[model samples]
Target: MTLLADRHGRTFPYLRLSLTEACNYRCSYCLPDGWRADGGPRFLDADEVRRLVSAFAGLGMWKIRLTGGEPSLRKDLTAIIATVAATPGVRKIALTTNGCRLSRHLPRWRAAGLTALNVSLDSLDRERFRAITGRDRHDDVLAGVDQALAMGFDAVKLNAVLLRGINDDELPRWLDWLRDRPLALRFIELMRTGDNGEYFERHHLGADVIEDRLRAAGWTPCPRAPDAGPAREYSHPDYAGRIGLIAPYSKDFCVGCNRLRVTARGDLRLCLFGDFGVPLRPLLREDGQRDELMQRIRALLGHKAAGHFLHEGKTGITPHLASVGG
Candidate 1:
């Protein structure tokens, strides 16, 4: 199989697939204005998703991550996960969720060959959690985290968006929480995206500040495991797990980007901050012409930019994070 490489010679082996634009919680940073809980946007059906995964896997892609405004909202998520996991070239199948509904489905997903999970938990305080997620589901999320750890998946990660004057002060608390667990806690910097310019200006906190705080608390830098993603991992001498930072603005983490994003509607985003993408839903619905579909996908990969333009003054893309699959 031919590898999917762009003009800059970076090969993409990972795919972030958005299952739907619908979400239950209205996170302050993700969906500050609130969103429709009942109906918002439609998504590709299980079969269509399977076909796309097969096509990507045929091109040497091995990792597949199912993302969404909230992936757990989908009724057929387990079937989707099973389909992708059964695909020949796919080696890992993971999901990123708010974790509100993950507890009930953990066993089924694990049995279906799920390799990892990334749960979103922004704060440890109950009131502060409600303030951040715009919902009082902190206990539900924590329950899901407990379930994930109890199940013993290959890897389970917790993602937190760091905002100044918000959950930023809870960094030490988060580290303390991670001290006993085997999970990896990652703090992500806020990106100035689409309609979030004002929000970003008010809340964005650099990862450097988070690192200094960790250093002061006695956390030591450590080498990242070979299979690790974008998070710059660190550890403490006394802790059982590690802490990570994902600083997209203060640092250029795109030097070796090897992933592509496909929205639920089938638009392939080569770069997270770029507006250009190629629509593949219509093409996938065509007659059984797998070779032709593969050719088009390869051609599109060539157009991916060497790096995003966020560092050069571009605020963000036109689509919001919810629609863009986070």
Candidate 2:
């Protein structure tokens, strides 16, 4: 089997597939106003998804993460998960959501073949969570996370966008929670997109703060998994849970890039912040085009850049995190 390698020598074993661009939360840094733009009222159907995953799986991709504005919003998500799980060579099926409906739908999702999960939980403090995500469902989300831990998933991660004064001060609460819980919590550095420049300037906190604190407190770096996300994970002897930092602004941040993204509309985004997308939706329309689908994806690797240009303040065409499944 052929491995998905780019010109820069980075091999991709993971794929972040956006199922839809419809989110219910109005997160401060992400969709402050909720989803407002393109990429869809019409997302790729289950059959197209099956074909897409089959193509990727045949090319050495084993991990497929279903992401979205909020992936749970899709009613057919279970079918999508099952389709991916049934694909040959696909070993892991994961999903990232806002967690509003996690408790209501998790068991069904797990049974449908979801192997891992990530929930967008910006804060543990209810009011702060409401302030950040514009949703008063923190309690519900936390309960769902607790339930997820109870279920024996291969991995369960919590994602929080690191904001300067907003949720940055809430790490103590997370650390306290993580001391006993076995979940993996990751703090992602706020990224600049087509929009949110002013907000990014106001709330973009360096991820080094969390890293420094973790290092000082004696959290040892954990070996990265072959299909791990971009986060640098660390563990402490005293805590059952682990902490990870996804600092996109840090020097050489993209050097460890291992995953590629595809929008809900079926456009393949080589870089999350890539200025352009090579449309793959047309190729996904038919099973007979699997070779062409893989060919288009494979050929694009030769043009993949060494790294993203976020350091220069170029946010690319991404108007919001939800739009591209961030």
Candidate 3:
């Protein structure tokens, strides 16, 4: 089995799988106002996902994250989790959800061997949350968070997209909430992609802004978790868990990127902000092609550009962020 290493010798061990392209929340960032009319998305079947995960896990891939418009929307999500959890080389199985449907399936997911979770929660205020997500289920998301904690998910991460005039004011409240809660909170900068071009232009808050806010709030920088993304991790004087800031647009971490994204339809995206991808479905379906898949994956890893050019004036000739990996 060959380990996939990039041109810079960065080991490619993390795989982020977009289980489905459909999502419940019509967030203005990734998708436009009416995405269905623009174009329909192709979702992968459970068997195909299992096969791909098995092959990659065999090729030195260890960490797997199930993402989606909202991964929990998949009816067979638990089964998928079980398959990947049972894979030979897989050591960690996690999910990134919108938290709208987490409460109902927390037990099932934990039972299926999910070790950690990353839930998207931009605002604490109900109306604001609804306005941002275009859904009126903020309470349900909060309830789901509590249910996940009760279900004993080891690491419960809250991903907050830091919008300048929108959710920026709520940062302190989120930090205060994390002071007692055991969950790790992450503040992510807005990226320029999909229908978010204008939104990102207007509300792209960087790490410096967040660091200043944390400093004013008397918070200090802390060590980042080993497997966490490029978030500038931090902690308050007496907080239980930690806070992280993912500044992809303002401060790119592609130099330390150890992960790659595989779209639901078998497209291998070397970088999250990459415009192009190599299709692996055809090769995967061919007879006696496991070695071929590894070769293609290695080739794609070598082609992994320096970084994703998703900032202003950058273009990714591929699908939206939702279709790639949210």
| Candidate number of the best TM-score | 2
lDDT of 2 by residue, 146-183 (tens): 99999999999999999998888887888999999998
Over 7-81, each residue of candidate 1 has an lDDT whose tens digit, in order, gives 887777889999988788878887877665446435788877988888889899889999998888888898899
Task: Give the runs in model 1 whose Cα sits over 4 Å from its true position.
Answer: 37-41, 216-218, 225-227, 313-318
Q: Write the per-residue lDDT of candidate 3 for residues 1-326, one digit (tens) a residue.
A: 45677778677678999988777787766664634633544577787787788778877988899998678878999999999999998988999998887777888889998999998988999998888889999999999998887777778999888888888888668767877788888888777765566777788877678788778877788774445567778777678778887877655477777788888778998877676878888865644777778777766677878777765467575456677665
**10 residues in a row with least lDDT, candidate 2:** 33-42
**Model 1 lDDT on a 0 to 1 scale:** 0.83
Q: Against the hidden true structure, what lDDT does model 2 obtain?
A: 0.90
Total clashes for model 1: 0
Worst 10 residues of 1 by lDDT: 33-42
| Model 2: residues with Cα > 4 Å off, grouped in runs | 37-41
TM-score for each of the candidates = 0.94, 0.98, 0.93
Residue-level error in angstroms, candidate 3, position 127? 0.5
lDDT of 1 at 150: 89
User: What lDDT score is found at residue 144 in candidate 2?
Assistant: 94
